[model samples]
Target: MTELDLATKAPESDAQEDSSVDSPTQSSPIMGDHEHCVTDRPAPAGQGPTGEIIKLNDIDVYISKPADYPHAPTRLLLFLTGGTGIKSVNNQIQADKYAAEGFLVLMPDMFGGETAPGGKEAYVADNSVSLLEQVKLKAVEIAKSFLIDMWLARVTEAKIMPILHKVIEAAHEEYSDAIKHGEGIYAVGYCVGGRYVLLLAKGTQEGGNDEESGMMKAGPFIKAGALAHAASVTPDDFKNLQAPLSLVCVENDALFTDEVRKVGEDLMTQDNVEHEVQVYPGVPHGFAVAGQYQESNIMDAQVTAYEQMLRWLKDH
Candidate 1:
């Protein structure tokens, strides 16, 4: 089969809430590692919004419930955001798209309110600049993750695990009727968010081994997951898979590096993991979230990635 139709083994938005309940975001945990919700009854999807924030662990969780939800239990998915954190327009837009496709999409802010400064401006690629200049910018941003109190340090495993658990609990509580199929959840992540899904894909095994793949159980965590232009993750994160995975990557991402991307590919193709990896050759790291922009509109690369993401969600 083609790379797009791979049978290789591998592993692992937002809108607003219009509810009366006051809700809002932060959940972090370590990598085998760091840790990582949903709601309301909404009608069919639309261009406007198929999502809303509801209170889960006292934080606002952006969610979109498909009209035919719970029909396929795996339709429930947890959406982990990248350095952009949550509540951004890009995230909300993606969440709506997922919900529109019949998936129950949930996203909680992983960085609390301390998201990386600058939004899309900080990430837009400038074709005129030297590649070295672009690489330097990425290096500076990654280095900040190590210093105490930067975005990554603040959302360490210990800090975010509780909230991540509560997110699942909240999902169970919200979709009480369809409890049987609800446990086996799916997850999708963008950028650093993909790191979190791999951690969950690490499964419940303490040594982080998926020897029996028991962790892919009808889980309160995840049954399967997908990653798009992922960043800030390591080989230790993606090598072993407890479940199925769909990875959508880009050509020039420093964070998702050639080394790391190769490991993911080998795991799916060489190793025994069940996975699918798609690399968008000319796009930047955040293409899934409309990272490349034109005047007042996002470029078509975002659309292409969007179609890929939804297809992975459906097939997997």
Candidate 2:
């Protein structure tokens, strides 16, 4: 597997955490409601994003933070990439942008060792193999099909969440003061990763019932979320979501337009879930990547979508 030129070592301690909490808009008390837990605890680790790679769980992952992260207790903007491979530089640029906006950013390569186009397919195939392995360790009452689905969910979570938790925790360990006063952590996913935002909000998968073979206890990590250009998530899967979620889809994105609408509609109607769904006109599926469209109008549409998210975050 080819690795990007990310500096995988621990970050230099020069970037001091922001100590002030004097914003015009005070953060709402959301994170305080989360009951801190002591489950199977995973010790914290970090991977630097400056073209260095750090190996965690034997997989080389990259991370980065901004120079003037302001040491303020801050929120997080976690980006999950889609079908296309997650380019390290692209993620660093995005993370830098988020840090500039006062958010600690995290981007993980869930593609494992595969390349894009073919890389997404390879991820699913590898997941299938991992599912088989997990099935061998299942309880006798669990059917093979049920075990397979649970295992697949577990494989996905294992590939992504551990690293996510590690990244956030590492930031906290290095900048505890900033975190102690942080606003709240939020998540956003694009394409397949958009679906992942929902999955992460739903928490870890328990055994699925007879009708549904994969079940999850809602996780408290993400307080709010945004999903753009997403696909493959079903409405049944989202009934467990308790966070405020906003979904943005391009008019031309047939995947979200056709199939995902039902999921959005279902979410809108649910009680205790604050959500919004908007379709941008004339943009493509990956328009958020910035250079995907040459037309300024299309770019504007994507920017508008992003602005909506920022506004919602500030409001909610």
lDDT of 1: 0.55
Per-residue lDDT over 1-316 for candidate 1, one digit per residue giving the tens place of the 0 to 100 score: 2232211111111111111111112111111111111111122244355478777756568888777666655367788876555666567767877777777778977666656433222232345545555556445434432332245545565444455566766676775443345446778887667767776776452332222222222332677788776655666665556767788776644445666667666665665667777766654445566332442222465676678667766776
Error of 1 at 225 (Å): 0.9
Give the per-residue lDDT of model 2 (tens digit) for 35-90. 00001111112422343344533444444455555544466566665543345344
Model 2: which ten-residue window has the lowest total lDDT?
Answer: 31-40
| Model 1 ranges off by over 4 Å | 1-50, 67-74, 119-149, 176-183, 205-220, 269-271, 290-292, 295-298
lDDT of each: 0.55, 0.47
Residue 52 shift from truth in candidate 1, angstroms:
1.7
Error of 2 at 122 (Å): 20
